[model samples]
Target: MKIIGIITSPRKEGNTAWIVNKILEGAKERGAETQVWYFGDLDIQPCRGCWGCHKGDRGCVIKDDMQKLNDAIDHANAIVFGSPIYMMQMSAQAKIFIDRMFARFSPRYSPYFKAENAAQKKLILAFNQGNPDSGLFQSYIDYTKHMFELLEFEVKEVPVVTGMRNGPAHEREDLRTLLKDIGSSLVGE
Candidate 1:
């Protein structure tokens, strides 16, 4: 199985990336083909409210890096999404990436909608927050979980790491072990 990791933090070598790498490490240890994407390094344009994909086109129409990203997602059996909490929501980069998935929503509203079955695909959400308490981001977390559910991903885990402004997440042994365990569970290791 191929597992893809996406980091949406704008900061180079940011905490969210560090955590995502750790998860990928565990997946690699289990012999799963893995790929990672730093969204900050990609030119993922915001959605243009165009219904091209919904109206008989195969995929998105904005014609940027998102198409490649979507292709990777289409082939992956599992996905790990890492994003830093910004103002109690996912970072702008992550939000834009999610918004670009508007094409997947059309079968419900349009007669021209072409539905793709992305169900049963495993998904893990990792969020890094400045607040010490994870409880503060419950609503935001809930929204994320619900959104992914709507998109047909089999939500496996939502791991939130709080109070991460001082250091990289790689140095946190507890988180490292937790993420590693999550990764192993992905391939039934």
Candidate 2:
């Protein structure tokens, strides 16, 4: 199995990246091929509300780095999306990446609206927040999961690391073990 970890945090060594890398490590230990992508290192731009992607097999116009991400997603059996909560919501980088995923779906009204990538891909949504209470952003987390479900991904887990203002994820052994287990579980072990 091939799993891809997408970290949208600007800090490469931040809590979000630590969580994502730990999960990838567990997946690797389970004999699954894993790759990690840092959004801060990519030049992905925000999606323009253009119908270009649905027009005749043509994908998103004005593409920069999202094309590579699209191809990676198409080939991945599972994906782990990690982001640092900003203003009680996903970071701007994560939001942009999610927006670019629109190209993967054709409009329902169009005749070409078929499940192009019908295979249900497993997904893990990981988030780190400064708030001590994990339940503080439960509603937004649920909404994010539902949105990805609508995109045809099987929402496997939503792990939120709260009270991150105190320390990074790597410093918390409990959180590290929990995320690693979640990653291993992704490979059906």
Which one is best on TM-score? Answer: 2
Query: If scored against the real structure, what TM-score would every candidate get?
Result: 0.91, 0.94
Residue-level lDDT of model 2, residues 1-189, one tens digit each, is: 999999999999899999999988888889999998999899998888877887877788965988888788889999999999999899999999988777787555243345577347889999989988988999999989887777777889999989988976777879768888999999864
What RMSD does each model have against the real structure? 2.8, 2.3
Q: For each candidate, what is the lDDT? A: 0.84, 0.86
- In terms of lDDT, the best-performing candidate is 2
TM-score of 2: 0.94
RMSD of model 2, in Å? 2.3
Off by over 4 Å in 2: 109-114
Question: Please, what's the RMSD in Å of model 1?
Answer: 2.8
Give residue 37's lDDT in candidate 1 (0 to 100). Answer: 93
